[model samples]
Target: MATEQKILIIEDDTFINRIYKRVFSLSGFGIELAQNGEEAMAKMESMNPAPTLIILDIMIPKISGFEVLKRLKGDVRWQKIPVIVMTNLSEKTDEEKALNLGASLYLVKSDHNPREVVLKAKELIDKQIV
Candidate 1:
């Protein structure tokens, strides 16, 4: 039931968000969007049955994506939701930091093609479902 798979995307850029929404939709995944970390958290709190996965952007307004990841990892209910960190920041330190903070996949937006990113995300989600 891949179509039933719900994904939450927390990104500040409207263009990027639209791109992601289209990508996931094309892949038959149910997608939800949040403009900021705070809005993402609020949406998570109210999401029915929770989300299967989360696509997070490191640099965002209101609250940084790292803070959101930290909070999600701390909460038992949401801790199990696999997070794919998608950011333009390609530093080794940043990637390590995100992994240590509980991100399941850390992807450099500038390095990977959109299809590759989507494939990696599907792999993570499939692993979790299995």
Candidate 2:
């Protein structure tokens, strides 16, 4: 088995967070959770060794996912880490916005099950494709 890669998942919905935690855990990923943008930023700063990847939600409270992506991509420390924008935003504009801001992948939540998301995440990390 590959060494488990850590992922910071920024999602505000309790049910969704729980689902992500469960799925990721089963897939051999270490998870760090944050409910809002402020918490996300703080977690990023405090996570020991940092996270290998990030799963971001756009409609989160405070800072907004777009802003979070901007901050992450702008910072030298987090720029190279892959970010997957798993959001409820389904419009082309939203997708473009996230991609423009440096999201490595954008997946609309309603279109994919949590397990599918986890699989995609694993592939992304394995390929080291940013």
Clashing pairs in 1: none
lDDT of each: 0.91, 0.92
lDDT tens digits, residue span 1-130, model 2: 5655789999999988898989999888899999999999999999888898999999999999999999999999999888999988899999999999999999998899899998888887778844
**lDDT: worst 10-residue window of model 1:** 108-117
Model 2, residue 103: distance off in Å is: 0.4
Model 1 agreement with the true structure over 6-64: per-residue lDDT tens digits: 89999999988888899888988898899998899999999997999999999998889
Off by more than 4 A, model 2: 1-3
Candidate 1 TM-score, C-alpha based: 0.95
